[model samples]
Target: MKVSVLVITYNHSRFIAQAIESVLMQKVNFEYEIVVGEDCSTDDTRKILIDYQQKYADKIRLLLPEKNLGMHRNFVNTLQACCGEYVAILEGDDYWIAEDKLQKQVDFLDKNLEFTICFHNVIIFHEDNQYQPYLFLHNQPPVSYIEDLLIRNFISTPSVMYRAGLVDNIPNWFYEQGMGDWIFHILNAQYGKIGYIDKVMSAYRIHAEGVWSSKNRDWQLNKTIKMLDTVKSNLDGQYEEIIDRAIQFYSQHLLKLNSIHQGTTSKFTTNLPKHLELKDINFIVFPDWNQEEEHLYQNLYCLVRLLLTHPENNRIALFIDTTKISEEDANLCISSILSNLISEEQLEKNKNINVFLVGKLDQIQWRTLTSFLKARIVLDSENSDALLTSGTEIIPAYTVNQLIEFGLIFIGSAKPYKLNIGCGNVRFDGWINIDIEQNYKTVDLVCDARQKLPFDDNSCELIYNEHFLEHLTLKEGLFFLKECYRILKPEGILRIAMPSLEYVVQKYMSDDWRNQEWLKYPEYQFIKTRAEMLNISMRWWGHQWLYDTEELYRRLTESGYINIQEFAWGKSNTPELRNRETRVDSILICESQVLK
Candidate 1:
């Protein structure tokens, strides 16, 4: 045989068929066979492999082990079975995108006898995420030597094609190494230089079940350290410095394992805008002001002194000139102070701290101001006189400071709260899990999401729901959004994950379903015809309404939200909301703010 594709699989029932079909689809002039080593998978992987072998009886061979042989043993046994001029490695979860992938590599290897291995670029796509696909070793040079292979395993497994007879009996250490692909590449590199094709011909799938993909950085680092140690012993300390440097870098990475902020003490320094800066203290009153304007500056200075004394206290001084300044100007100034002076984190923390010093304000003014700003009022007192001494009356204003302190009865303390609505089985840390079904003990509140939430108005800091919005009808969805807006505090975030109408429509209409590369996967074959695909798009999983970006944006805007931003699947500004389990290509994420 000219080429033998060595495919190693274990419990990869969902992906094995695609791997086999990719080989079957290859446009090779010479004969090639696929050698799949089924390591006695507990899943339907073995059955799937057997079916593929029957379908491609002449071209496919299976090493069906009675018991689990483990990854290292299975890989070694699989490699030994390939009796071809050249062999390519493709893990069950990975697939070749290019039909001429093998032909191109074989031609290159046939001409370049000095090269021990031939590899090309591979697209590394996350199985559970819609993140933009990235090329593996995108910047690596076209030609790589043994020294390059030693430093990094730049060649992805699916992209590699090496001389078949180059490797006979796999080393004992290879069985013990955490990353078998690294050792395999290193072994081939020892014979001659490694060749690289610049074009992307394959895709490497990263999912929860992946060997190195699922492992934490600490585990991966430890594995790397062990592999490097083994390499050092095998090579007689030839590449000591490079290996040592890598070990050192990874060892330091262990210190950063607990990346979550435990006790972050970020100091806040408020920088006033250039326009707000006192150029002679006359800017506040603007034009050539008389007595009232002059006195206003004196009161402002006193207020500034008081604020300086208690900088930590949440105090807001609103100097409103009903006659002099327009409402737009007043809004701009307030917006500037809040936006420039306060950070989002700080704002969330101090949302309930009501300490406002209002000047020249009526009931209408107070209503307008309070509607926008949720802060306490600072009343005139003996301390206020102490600063002003010869004060000519601090602008005729009414202070509801005492009333707010005594009358306003809050249902709960202003402790920031997060809510997960329609939370079927999933639970978020430090969040109230609400669901219609109370099957799980994690569910804190049980209620239908279509109705009003049990949460108090302007109480929740964040509300997130994945794959829940589409279940509601247009009217119900609008009501749900309104409810979310009502419960969320000013500047509270509402993150929603829903099925993408655009993605589904495109998938149904496109001829991508016809291609072998696309048809090889089961994810695309759920619906047979275009009508079924379209019907499934709307009716699947008891969906009432499906929305694209534009529709979703309109609904959110109508429900009184601002700062709306769309995120790719499994992506959000909020780290806690970035859950891969709730992600897919058909899933679209959106987040907006209940701007006060």
Candidate 2:
């Protein structure tokens, strides 16, 4: 055969027909065949290819796989199946516009003995947006080397035709990388120079499903850098300077992109809101003038109390200047603030509270830094009392000290509450159900129970968690127990129900392991042997630490609990905490109390 047009498609039912027709319309004098590797697509793309194969039986050869081989495997297998001396690529989502696209590329490679690959410019069409179509490349050189290609992949896949058998042994690393066309071009270009036809012959479509075009900017850049690093290592520094330059260029851009995404204003400045209205009270906590770490914690604690007390539509914004500290320190500070003051559950449910990190406070126009928050007042340390600004709309600003004083006066009036931490879909009628994820409908408050509980000391009447303690590590579990102890009032009960390690061991020793109903869940369906079941139980469901009655008693005692007791499944002495357990198999239940 003179040429073989290679087309690999998956889930491109809408555009497969056009791609097939483009190859058929090519006016060539030599014998050519269209080779299509149709991976198992969930859509009708395979059906379309089968119909085309039947109609053009002699001209088209379809290699349909029973299962999806993914893009890289399909491309490699299809490329190896080409019997012609030259191969032309046309992806299912793209098509050639010119009838003589293949003929011109074939003629050029045939005459130019030194050139192994040839390509032309293509019109890029954005299918999902209103962007006008443009050429993929401009002012193209007639001939290019591997060094020029190393800078970037400027060649469009649909417009490429290369001499077959140039890349006989594909590299194993090529399959691991996200890019295919660029690596293939690099492999082929190593044998000879790349010839550019300079004519716009094909149309490259960019849609939501297009693999390379669908990825975000950061992913694309990072993937490119990874690909280049692999090339650099595989080639053994054959083109180190060129590849290093390319890697550096992509790495710098990636850093800047990440900085911008993290709300860093080092490279660019963001405009502050001129005015905002709040339905309830708005508290804007300014940075400590002295930048004292202790003072920052005090302010955050005050804000957390304010949020818990008012549970109405109250808003609080805390500003942190990150320019004074390194990025790592800034991140540590933010994590400390969140893990100590507000849980992720609180941040998700109460969207009113915000923490803003500014790269430089001097760059902002407003005296206070507020972004994407609706607030009507500013709370600063300098302002002792509410100060009304002389403007079109007078906004009130209060000091943190005054807020603390106000909190001290009203904090005692708040009612005591019961908590159900890590409550996954098992909610109590009169208790506040809390979990890390907000997707659970029964979760009343979305916050991490592993973090500090958002409540006043000795204000909780009861605390309960079932099958949730094992999910935390030993250290984390201990810390969480102490948090529970701190929040519960004197003589307040704390109950915990979780999987019993002793029960699992007993089941493993006995012959009734296969009869356990809990192993039948879909997650444990892979357990075919007794050893697998025993191993999976300890590691599955994000389980970090398992406990028995003895270990449970020790843990509670370490967390400063008194009068620890063991109970049966769904059995608690306290009336409010009774019948709360849902799982009964291999379960261990324990209860303790906090005494001052």
Candidate 3:
């Protein structure tokens, strides 16, 4: 195999030798030469390149630009000057991970002439080697995506080795101010399927100037717009996916960064676009806004903030200017998204908990009827200001050094109240005995409730829960309600089960159980169903929303029942239920006063 290596440098005087040496030490059975482009570096970079040229004149082609030609131009000119059957790229600060990196790639492409570009994963590291980005330990994918690249960019530039004459000429846009070799990869992948060698090929140095290491706080993003624009400006529609992926790559990167810096609350804002893709949310309600001038994004931001603050896994009805997208088109988009979001295997309508999302104010009548009927309780998931007023409170009467037990912990188990929540030891006894993985506990029957009879309304009269719902997704929550309604008989009841919104707002606003370690357990799949069922009203999140004793009573009456009663535990300690002679926050149920 005959190959040419291109090493582009800006101000990499100190690290250039190490990069060059890696190429020199390659054990390839081929004729190869090194081409170094010292882009006008206002440092000792050029001098070092010429000095290396004098020593290894036969093996090296040093191009010293009279003045800095910038990275894009320098790379293009450097490649044009090199004459080799196959060309491999390397940057200044990075070095080969294995001397065989090139030979393996070259041999594969040489034999399979059908191949144009082949790349591999790089072990990224800091200058000090203190923190390595690529965890050979974690072991992620070796080589990946090029398609829908407007969606992602996994192949690094320095990791590529393409057959000569892959393109007629270097695209002019690469020399543009903000463009780089990624653009070239996009162009290359547009023509051929990307090939991979599942081994570390290079040590990608990640310093401040590293493409992905630096931090950018803006997480809500769309990359397709920029790519489409770029494609329109330079390459024509042929590179549409490339541009689109660039946008998605940036947006996804921002999402990850926000998760790192902003916490779970920010996810709602970041994932709104993703949620809008949900197929279940029909008739999206935008309470107020002119979507005509990017105001929709602003409105969404506000609503997402509200949803994050409360436990009610509810949606805010932000108003969008109907002129932007017709109701039919908008509904189609949201419904399709919801459909894609929830799989048939995991979703069961009219079972467990189901949330009905309405879009326009015209739908408020239906909402009111549904709310009056299904809303055993409805507090804005975001309205934490008046949270946990469930008329339950308790004191730390005594101290103990033991871990809390599930059965004995609930305070409402006394005379005035009884609740039927939590996996009954009687029914799930088999589950309790099962190990975390040996049984595949939850993913099978234990995890799902299909054959589990779901719930029986009067089974237990109240619910006592805490930090659990965020595990199962929104679809799972809907199923929980279906079970809730099915289980309840005429006057049967449910006590609130879960962490208080006030508690979450003040101390756990950004808390979510999805990312917890428990999710790795076999029971987590089943337990997560419980987590999704728990929600906060004001924040419109995991717990859904907080409930009041009276609202609970009202919902029963509205749902074709009679003789209802409720109590409020406003602004009081939770353990000691306000009216209950115990130390807990809970609600009681009686015959519904009104019958629907």
Candidate 4:
């Protein structure tokens, strides 16, 4: 199949070199034609494309738009101009990192007749082109079903290769609204499967200039809301689920845009997402300075109010240099009324709303030196009280252990010798709450469960912990479990929610490992380090045990814990919790009893 590489640009003279170089570098079995639509760039961006066309006439075709067609209109027009069976797009600001990005995509499309579109994971680089692991780390999996695509767009324009025929039926109204790309894919998926390559094959540059830049986030999000409505309206009975989910996502994104637009001062008004998670950054009341040029100080004052004291804005993370802040400054932020993000009214109004202050990133040295030293940013935030109280109670509530529905009743312990080691923050509403830390107000016992079971044999109905067991020393933890056997009813069960190591590696460590970069430099070979195959095995999250759901079954069964069934869930925090004390949120239910 003849693949048409549609390259569009407004003014990307500096980055075009890398973009063109990538196309020329492809070593594929089939030939691909490169057609570039230069949108009459006032700068030398057009001149660069002209030179590339002249040099590679056989491989490259350059189309000069008489005047600027703008971003959305430019790409849709390029489709009509380019003549090829297959279509792939590469915007000027972003470029392919992989030489085989096109070839691999084409090959996948060629072999998989059912699949019409293909995309791979992209690595997001800084404007200076620094290798940022955080972007890749957060990037979701490449291969997704139609259901996954509906939640949000995974394929960036630069990373996608689609069938040319699919676009012929698409109208200009989709593009005119500025969110043509999303509609393009949703339409294609209806015809067949969409393939994804699980590698970082493209470089996505994020800065002030691009259309989807953080500054233009409002335009993109607002446009996205419009597109979602269009998709929701067109949903046939079969596509209803995706469309419904899209509506929910549309509302969430709209609310996020609202939060971002109102200068981060306002509490989230739109009641959507059941559990809204904001990791760590505090900048509310940031005005749309780009839109309001005439009202500069008004925007500036709004930004200052947002920075200093903005009511209703809940900062999930505040990335500040703690060295520049004092106890007085801290008190202003903590006690400020405007900093009143999740009020009592807001909590009853919505569900599980969280705000935080994350203070670490590349080279933007946090004003405070000690900001990087905290063990767990999520647990250390002003809203930690809220996380513990997320589904249980409303705010002004500080204790995690004081919930009425802490009703995760375990029927029995696996073995009389089996010990319940580390119980994160999940306390039994009726049982003893034990931990070595004096800090947690609900801790019933201050001794480490890894060393011994403080209780006698055959006591606990069940040995249960949410996402907490993986953090203990394996040798000590194993011994502790053996002791739990000494205190369990014969018909007992060990209900544990340990970390799925595979899930963690894929989520944080695999292709990009930037989990811990605040205190030290990001060490490369990221996946292996996070897996802790070498010394990572020694102490991970201050833990000594690693298990997927499979190993948990083997370890407990070997220790004489009968009816030992293991359940796994995902947890995302620096402390990396797995069992009790931590709130485990998953829909999967596991019920078992110790062999009577």
Best by TM-score: 1
lDDT of each: 0.67, 0.73, 0.47, 0.54
Worst 10 residues of 2 by lDDT: 385-394
Runs of candidate 2 with Cα error greater than 4 angstroms are 263-596
Per-residue lDDT value at 525 in model 1: 44
Per-residue CA lDDT of candidate 4, range 1-596, in tens? Answer: 37999988887887888888978888888878998888988889888888888899998888887878887677767878777878988888878767778888888888888888888777665673222333342445545667667767877778888887874656546665666677788878777777877776777777667766645544665677667666766665666545544554444334433442455423332221322234323221212223333353333323223323322234322222222235365335543433343352343334323333322222111111111111122111233322222211110121112211221111112223323334434454445455554223244344666666656556555665544556666776677667666666777555665445555555454455444332132223334444454344334334457666566666677667665443444322212223333433231223245553
Model 3 weakest 10-residue run by lDDT:
390-399
| Candidates in order: C-alpha RMSD to true structure | 18.8, 20.3, 21.3, 18.9
TM-score of 1: 0.49
| Cα lDDT of model 2 by residue, 1-596, tens digit | 99999999999999999999989999998999999999899999999999999999999999988889999999999998999999999999998888998889999999999999999998887775334355678688899999999988988899899999988899999999989999999999999999999887888888999899989777887799889989988987899768766664565445434543664333322344323332212334334434577766566565555554444424444444444456587667666765654464455544454455544333123222222222222433422221111110122233444334323212223345778888876777556677775422365455777888877798887888887888899999999999888889999999988889998888888898877876653323457888987886777657889998889899899899999988887787798877888776628888998999
Please, what is the TM-score per model? Answer: 0.49, 0.46, 0.46, 0.48
lDDT of 3 by residue, 457-496 (tens): 3443333222233223445544544454454543444333
Scored by lDDT, model 3 comes in at: 0.47
Model 4 residue 201 lDDT score: 77
* Residue-level lDDT for 552 in candidate 1: 95
Ranking by TM-score: 1, 4, 3, 2
